[model samples]
Target chain A: MQPTSANFIANARDAIADDNLQLAIARVGENFGAKRQQAVDKLPEFDALCGRAVEIKDDVLAHLDYYLEVYERAVTASGGHVHWCATVEEACETVLRLCRSVDAKTVTKGKSMIGEEMEINPYLERHGIEPIETDLGEYIIQLAGEPPSHIIAPAVHKTKEQVTDLFHEHHRKFGKTERLTEGEDLVAEARELLRGKYLAADVGITGANFLIAETGSSIIVTNEGNGDLTQMLPKMHIVLASLEKVVPTLEDAATLLRLLARSASGQEMSSYTTLSTGPRRADDPDGPGEYHVVLLDNGRSELLGGEFQDILRCIRCGACYNHCPVYTSVGGHAYGWVYGGPMGAVLTPALIGLAEARHLPSATPFCGRCEEVCPMQIPLPKMMRHWREQSFQRRLTPGRERLAVALWAWFARRPALYHLGARFAIGWLFRRARGRGHMRKVPFMRGWTLTRDLPAPEGGTFQQQWRRRKRA
Target chain B: MSNKTQGGRATILGWIRGSLDRGELSAEQRAAIDSRLANPRRNLIPARAQVDHAAQVELFLEYLGAANGTFTRVAAEADAPKALSEYLSSQNLPQRVAMAPDAWLQGLPWEKGAPLLERRAGPARPEDQVGVTGALAGIAETGTLMLVSGPDSPSTLTMLPETHVVVLRASQIIGAMEDGWDALRKREGQGKMPRTAIFITGPSRTGDIEMHMYLGAHGPRRLHVIFIDES
Candidate 1:
């Protein structure tokens, strides 16, 4: 989980040239994007609900300390323990201690981005407790020994053939050697194999979509029922969540839930939206015995009241990922961290430091599709722009790029010089094109024109056209 | 709390307060936040869920079908076992079912109405093919069933089996998720909730492999709702 975001350009180049990744990204981009559009079109109140969701999150962020204290009190009153960890190491150590207390050998995990952020799997493995990802996507990637490619669909980058191969290799020890070609067979095989792990796991760990202060419950919205099975069968259940996930009440959570599924996968509702309050009640026939919540605040508190504070309102729906052109082109791993796409471009720098993830902000073309589709209305492109400005100010940008920008700024300050330079550059490019629509090679832009042609500029600048129109 | 945990708590809250550019909240500010939490406000409810009772029921059925969940309407609760039997036979599934030990479900005439059907009342086992439970309410907005776990209503019955059958009363159908929350508040009182409240819209599914959705992904493949109408 060490950040490779600084190598985003190299990673993106590899992703673009990857045939298998391209095939997978094509399907996800087309399918999830269209489905979200269809779901949004169905609900007349979708936008209104989005606005309300944003307001609710903003309210929580404004009174975050108060709400979190209230949330901690509620969890304690419900006989559940809440652990506050300011750093990922502390969070991982807390989980390890809990697992050790229970003498856990294996733990079942639902798909949790926060768990990925904490890198709890490897941490637990090193401490002698095995962690199993029960979600089919997370399972596939875990088998493949890779981080997730998408937030919701972890194995999205793996084609069916890749999954068949992964299963064939990993399931051989389980006495299953069949190379499953069909998606249904693959899913059934995983389901059959993981069902026992769920039963045997001593503890369950799931991420919270929303932590309700009203009921001290952690809500998980999943299409697969693995999360429920993970928590229900285990002796202990632990919820991993960032601090911003808390809401004032169940009613507030309901408003966000209304937009979650519709924006994420274009469903009216996910298959299962489970809210686990605390450990099993005394009279309960079946449930976990002990419940614990780990509230992680790794770098989130630093984002508050800053220009980047809006990113905390994100619900991790992956809507922005699906809608981002840059994300669709190169896919998630190109972003080089636990999160990817527009949100990651803005947030990775904040959490991991701008120096390590400076390239993420500059990876975008600033098309602004991410903000348009975001359920929380996080201004992703604007945040990315903020990161870019910070990068430049911090001298993280390349010296050559800085020089180019500085020169452009100098000219921009003098409008007459800028217009004259624009006229001269347009005339030279127009002649270089030889009436062709595009140029195959351009000086100092080999990276841009290598895979695609640069369109030839017209002979006149906008200023010339405007003055001509005015005179006519 | 351990000292380590207390340190973390103080550090995080301190940082949050510092970033928000404030000391501890004033009494007025605390009162405002406490009031907001005390009296939760309802936000926008979609027009789709705001309809007449008959229309809501119709919308629920429509959306349920759209979500790939099957349902059968019966005139009386006694007919539920018969309807469940018919559904199992139609789908060529086993006649055996693990039923939740809820008192309401136990009153159903499984033995009298469907003698051939084998039913065990308890939490669902891994080998169980079909599981039946009673739902707290059905949300008409998205065709979701709201179920709370308790001594009688085991959570496993809803997820462990390959096929899950729910017996919901038509009168228990609510307009939206907010209404469902309101009902839970009225039943459990404020700040008191069941251990788990699951809202199931359809059978378990996954689009993980090649983004091709497959049902019965580690949960029930078929979700059959048996609606009892005693009106």
Candidate 2:
């Protein structure tokens, strides 16, 4: 995956132009948001749960090095192999080597964002090994040859009708000619299609939501039973997860689970919450014969000792995405990477240098809704501001924005000049708009006016209004 | 591909030593791991005593009812056949049922010669009705069911159907979420959790697309709970 966070604002502006997608997104987002709010309100201990979750994550990160070692030891002791990769390419190569070791002809996959980050599907395909996405949303996107749009709902941007069309186009190549009109028909078709792949595949790939260091386990949650099938039926199972997913113990993981579902989808619990440690036991009747954990550092080591370290606490519950105003408007694909929404904004800059993802931090209207709803309570806007500062320092920001900031700072040093400059601009803009009272066109403000007109500065600046009120 | 190129790949020992030399982690930090591992036990918040099975069952029914799921109780596993027969008749459905062949179903006596109604397979279609074999370990504190799939039970029973009728044994019920986790860990082991361990409270539901609540949008529309008590 090439980083696309920089082009998000531009892509989002174009996405909003599609009336149907905009309508569906707005309607769906508002409903999930309200349901989540109601769910939180029903539980008196919701805030306490959030606090406990954050504390658990904080403790785990503080001792992450220890927990990671413990996790590695336990997993290896259980007859599983552990490989540490410092970057995305290393991780991908490790997985490929493992596949070659097993002579894997076909691979079945559960939803793993780390796999997306490594662009594993294409890599596996290039090696002449087939990789099938078992999750319904992921499978649909796979058929369309598009990246997943949402963390939870990978194909959230596509409508049911669109899915029906995609299935019609691809189903025939597999010798299936029937076209499904309803959602259920589509689901049934996908189930039959993926099951054959699952049974025939030599290896299974999945993502872990949390890595329990105490027990050396990889925890996964899913509503559909496909993930279980992927991990169990295949001869080999591989988990690709980031370095920061480790938690100290089962109890800490329990605390995080209490808030994960409620924050993500307002469910008391998801349909399936699974934790796998190594390969199957000697007494176990059914499971993969081999298990491997690929731990990807991918620039996270630098984040461990920095101000934006709180971002490492993220469990990818996607609460921040659901609550973001910008994400709700454009949906996930516009972020143009494996992760999207508020978490993506904070993470994209850190993973793929700030020089490339500069606009992601500025894309936010600074709404602060992401922080308010985050399960780990990651101070997202503050982290984004840190990214912005880095962008400014690196001279990555455009010349115009830099000049504007410099001029504003200069006038800001002289309070009288600042008030006069603001007052004059406001009066002139208001008069130019002529009672319409909004600037449809303005110099050096095309970014603001591109999507929506800016409301004329309300007759005067805040400083002037505040001084007049005080005198009165 | 060549021997020289193969040798170019760094060894694990080299990487470890390099990381150590980077000096990112402190010496005190490396020592702390040994101390923590030497003593693994930590203080735990003891879970509360379990509620009686009857009360636990009733609480689950009530919670499910609040979430708009239907409920029916049978005398035993044998009674499930008659119960399902009448239930199926009432819905005026054909002799097609998607069944997850778990241990629970093996224990149940299917209609003597009904030819095991068209076995629903693979992904659930909206038209399909699946009979899931449930090993329900209920959490009374939150009124939840912990379902695990194995040889006796297939994963398809809970999902891939229009209606789901889960048979819950009284003994399988536990008191709290933690207890259920502990029990599951003990059964499977510290490491191997099932691929899909669904803690379902009620039927499949969604409020998206519009605020109007819609049940059975993605998964099962009607969830019917069957309580079986051998005692």
Candidate 3:
């Protein structure tokens, strides 16, 4: 069951109503954005690095078919099995099939948007395989059975007390004796519970942050070692990745890696950056016996030849979301689906048709903060406008919105009538309000003035004031 | 971004991918791959960076301090156990410390009375205070330590403990990211890499709750790096 934009908006409003979430979000953006600026200031060639990173992605995408083949060959050469999935269903089926082949009863997963995008947990559940999310935030959300609201912080919508209650409720079945009191206590409790799951799980699944074509290595950056454990310890390891994650070489990936952590969390680097190439060797005492790489194309192949190609370069750093005014106001869940924030606004409509996601593009305030802070320098506002144009062309926009825009456009093109009509309406409306200096009700703007009063017009219209100034 | 195109005109991307499919590499991709391939010809692909005793000690202190890890430079491998014991005693850690099965660790001199449990098979309990192991390599760029699983440092010692104490030798330091990958390749041989090569930069942290970072979210809360200058 996919959540619609309306449902997400309701959830986000509730999340914003929480005092803790607001305070935490306020502290995060200011500190993280400042630290990232400091890091970039030290590196004189940061912009050049971004350009190079963009270039590498662009080139790889142009030759994606060849590069994917090269990556597959390299992985196979390194004794890792590579599975190609043309769609999300195929990708999910491939992972489930692998799990079944291994007779996997328990599966532990790292935080992967790809996993979220494919709805992997429910698929695994249907097969009677319990997929345990190892990342703390992911684990919390999995227990709550909710889709992640934010990209970086999946359970950002949750408060500490909520997490505590969740843990208490979930841990009751496990016969947990000690009740956690603080945030730290809760973390320790989760760790103790997940440790056994890590060791016992037959298969581990994670999403690749980036896949190196030259080395057949899949890069996963995590501040927690959950990703590491998810890739190791288990006998079988699977890395789910999109086609756009491929890079030409390790050096190119290095440039992007430098930016990823600083932009995401203001860290010099994530606590754990694991690069796994293949399965364990004979000399290795403990590691996964079988390694699998699932490359999901989904809609990316079509996106390659479209206007949304630039979105493929996103590193999922969540910087845009952190700095975005709309995102800060309404939060991530408001946009709905796997991805939220500005990226989701442009991407959701692209992946799923504009009609199903018409309201998502309209969710933004067009403050342009997302584009300004975007490390990839994606023209997000322009893309949103593009979607708006598409919606208008398809008549997916509401009748009222269409009428309003049409009226504005008609008056805008005819200057004489527009000015006369604007002046008369302003004066007439003011007189009708009986010197109240504001209006509590307007025709189409009833929704707008319902909560607050609209300030009366100052003096007269701009055209009238300009004419009087010219005469004087 | 346009919905429609001319009768026969292909889009910018169509032209690019179509040409690439015909083996006509773009000027950019060709340039990048060529430059990378040509790098070895210019400079004999230098050996991995090495750190000596003093340098390793300096790096250990700097990295540990920067990354919120505690470090003590010991004069000899014999003094390692004493420093570790002192750290644990001060922190009120349990009497028993889990030691990895390594030859270098076995050579350490400890208090004659204290009991140190050598690592065995199976899951480690929550009561476990510390796990000691040697790092496979250290990355200078990110101040990270690469831990490879083997007989020397069993994998469980890394994840199971409340505190992790890593004994690092200075000489194994590598300068570049590629140097680390090269070393891993050489160690694993062709077509074989470990299922996991964890490059731990600092303690575990997450900003999941409205982006308030809390360290020790899932892994070891405390990391102690013991720099050994055997040189």
Per-residue lDDT of candidate 2, residues A55-151 (tens digit): 7777666666656777887777767777877778888888898899889999999889999989999999999899999877788889889897767
lDDT of 1 by residue, A9-96 (tens): 8999999999999999988789989999999999998888888998899989999999999999989888899999999999999999
Best by DockQ: 1
- Residue B190 in candidate 3 has what lDDT? 41
User: lDDT per residue, candidate 1, B1-231, as tens digits?
Assistant: 499999999999999999999988889998998888889888888998999988888899899999999999999988888998999999999899899999988988889889999889999898999999998899999999999999899999999999999998889888998888888889889888899999999999999989998999988999999998874
Worst 10-residue lDDT window, candidate 3 chain A: A1-10
* Clashing residue pairs in candidate 1 (N, C-alpha, C atoms within 3 angstroms): none
Q: What is the per-residue lDDT of model 3 for residues A360-391, given as tens digits with 9 covering 90 to 100?
A: 77777898988877778788888888899899
Which candidate comes out best when scored by TM-score? 1
Residue A347 lDDT in model 3?
Answer: 87
Against the hidden true structure, what lDDT does model 3 obtain?
A: 0.74
How many clashing residue pairs, candidate 1?
Answer: 0
Local distance difference test, per candidate?
Answer: 0.92, 0.72, 0.74
